[model samples]
Target: MSGPAAALSASPAGTGPDQVRGPVITGWSAVSPYGIGRDAFVQGVSSGRATVSVLDTERWPGPDELACLVPDFDVREVLGKKGTRSMDRVSGLAVTAVRELIAESEGAGLPAGGEEVALVLGTTTGSAQSMMDITRDTLIHEKPFYIDPSHIPNALMNCAAGQCAIWYGLKGPNTTVAGGRASGLLALNYARRLLTAGRAHTILCGAAEEYSPARSWLERHTRHPDENATVLGEGCAVLRLQPPGTHPHPLAELLCITTAITHPHHITTTLAHTIKRALHQTRLNPHDIWAVSPSTPPGTTADHERHALDLIFTDHTPHHIPAPGPIGDTAAATATFQITTLLSHHQQHPQPPNRIALITAIDRDGVLATALLRLL
Candidate 1:
């Protein structure tokens, strides 16, 4: 068998949650092209081989030749009939990822009416298609009377966060963060606070984005391949944040997470500052970082962020695995992949450096968000 298949072939019990040390990951799931779960994603990024794959030509065409979107999985298998109707693709991806995380955490068996749990969700675009669909219906169908109000709820960017809290029955500190791509990293940091204050014992934190035709249409004209920028893609990433000693055999710890906003010109420098801030907050050095997981094709202003790494550290990143390389860009999913990359690196080698896993992004609208995350 291959890497991930080999890993999955083993019983989850041998290395499942309920078995590790402090600040454990407890649970995690990714809706990416590399497959679901951290192990599958790590296998693709570490495979060290090149492959070209077609992505969304029929429905959502983009300039890029390929993308790492989730394939071969059905939402119905994981989500039942009643729950599926309330979600948009973005929400679907997120909740699906969260389902896996919960299963891994054994939260799937959460006691009935366990209102102590809560969910903090994040997203750059919650239901782009819902908005587009309404517009198309109004223009083509020529009747506002037939417009569906159900999509109105799904159309909002915060719907993913709200839908998750409703479905999971979690009633804790439910905050929907808005930090552009850094939202995923910030979401985890937000959950950590709930645990710290004893406000919630386990917080489900995540980010999600759905594919949009308009976004793809714009990419064809605006994106630069040489610079490695692409269009919006669909996916979600979820992590279960728990108190330091709640579970064992859990993966990595959430050392700290922080965010910063700056002018587009200062992308790299700003990211460096935020990364150092994360290290400072955790009291560590840059060299101690074993890896830096930034998304590939670092958009215009954000390109400097990667170049800045060269200036700061002599060691080329152990693996320049830009997350979206194995799992197309889902905006917020960038931070999700960042978290997975960090945990994957740790699982491969014991005693990973108390390093900062950095993420930076600048959107076409000129908004930039930079964040740093580390294991505790």
Candidate 2:
């Protein structure tokens, strides 16, 4: 993440470590097939759109023609070549989106001078495309170790997070996460807990993933394509969690974040349970939530992913398919987009009281992460 100094209120009055509420997501940006920034996302969701082109169809090992491409974004505008070369497109997306997020609200998502900054990320596949490149060198070209050793660092799961820390000059706790699509929500929950527990005052927390060439090959070979409905898309969401307070452009107050895993058939029940548990944790009522940013399915579960989700939390308003659905890509982008949408709802219309925004994601691994965001 880049931009102005965002300072969290250190030792706010009347709040100790246990009393400290979870992080309030000040701002965020998403780079997806829908395009760059939040404006494109709102448009896509407004139209009920999805990317149509065949995914990774080429046998020659390269990116697919059709993707939810972010419109008009160049790294050079934000970083010099020296800094940009170390990052892959996926990591570039991860860092740039966070930078835009930080730009919206200066220095709130990060620590001021002398404060600790932790890096926690969630991703299903680290940089599988890089790995695929190396494998291609060996198999397709019969060239052993033909890949660049410099590019080998991104092959690990935590490489993205580590590189982000180095690139951004953050020197605090750092880690990576992989829980399938649930990685994003889990990352947020974990970061929130760390701040609450006083492990670190601030964090650059998010996840990164991409539809790699390897994923495409695997899907083509897999007998059951439906099993891989979750698209192999790459995106990341970085939220600077600070003790609860009024942020100038807060999409919503991240009241509570929680997760669970259940059978695919019982997803609705598990989702409801997670929502209930979050509410119980925060002492919130169903009617308090004005809208929900629910997850969209990629044909894995029944087409009734929304119906199944609504059956659990039918009392609240569910209008748009919030967040990731707008982009038609999978990963933590859903949760991050959900959070951004929740905050945007309140940002657009001020004084939206009790404007609780709920974000829920059902992952392929049967993991359900439900986050409660309040626009207080």
Candidate 3:
């Protein structure tokens, strides 16, 4: 075993309380364009293979012809036949990712389900296709009220989170946040607060997005006319978060997570400030950072993010792990994939103990976020 497989095989067996100071990430799983499990994602990223594929125009009629979709992912096939008659792509992705995370946790001899567990998911919108389809039916049918009752749930933004809770028997806190590209960090921050307030014993924090003609059309119309259109993509990533010492085998310790809203004109300064605040809160200097995973989509926003990072790390250069471009623009799941990239990089390339990794995210809608993690 060599490369990423060898690194993954060398994961720490356990850690002590004194070794980790904040909430620890016990495990994580992702359904990416690369494939379905953590290993697939790690290998796809490590190998740098292309994930973009031409879309079937009949199934996905839109301006964009290519997308980074989960290969051969069928809702009914991936999930099952029962209770999936109306399951949309987004919900299926979320449910599958969460299910994988639960299985990983249980395999590691860790508790995963019960009343003590909570779920927090982030998304741009539920399923644009489902919503548009229902609306179209209502308007086209002779009777205005004619619509599929089963598809109603898929249109709601909280449907994915709700489904995870119901399916996994998590009775604690269930929340859905909408923050565009910064959603993953926002979800992480919300999960940490829940743990601090004693709202739940553990939290499944992540984000999900789906690729569809409706979303593609929405992107085409919303994007700046001058900016180059990005290749839309979709996926989901979920992490099992618990307070320090709750689990001995941690992937990383969450030092701090911070977010802010500012005008687009002040994005660079605001993001720099957010990063500085996270560093201060964690009592870490820029020089302590060993690597960075940034979720800055292409165009003006990417330049702004680069400027912000340059402003903060003027003294030294930390190794940069570029965003998962091979996976295309994951939207809400951008930050989650960014975090996962850092973890995978650490595993493949061993670093000194207590070395920190930084993750920064910026959304066109004035949302900026920063998170610091200590690799274990």
Using lDDT as the measure, the top candidate is 3
**Models ranked on TM-score:** 3, 2, 1
The 10-residue segment of model 2 with minimum total lDDT is 1-10
Better of 1 and 3 by lDDT: 3
Tens-digit per-residue lDDT, 27-73, candidate 1:
77777666666666667557733333576577555455565456654
Query: What is the lDDT ranking, best to worst?
Result: 3, 2, 1
TM-score: which is higher, 1 or 3?
3
lDDT of 2: 0.62
lDDT of 1 at 301: 46
Off by over 4 Å in 2: 1-21, 38-65, 72-78, 107-109, 138-146, 221-233, 246-251, 300-308, 314-321, 324-326
lDDT of each: 0.61, 0.62, 0.85
Q: lDDT tens string, model 3, 1-376?
A: 4432222221121333355656778889999999998999989889988998999999999989888999999989998988788899999999999989887888564444467888999999888898999999999999978888898888899999998888788898999999999999999999888877677778999999999999999998898754556888899999988877677667888878889999998999999999998887766778888888888776788889999999999999998988999999999999999988888777788776677788999998789998888787
Q: Candidate 1, which ten residues in sequence have the lowest lDDT sum?
A: 7-16
Q: Return the lDDT, model 3, position 224.
A: 74
Global fold similarity of model 2 (TM-score): 0.79
Candidate 3 achieves a global lDDT of 0.85
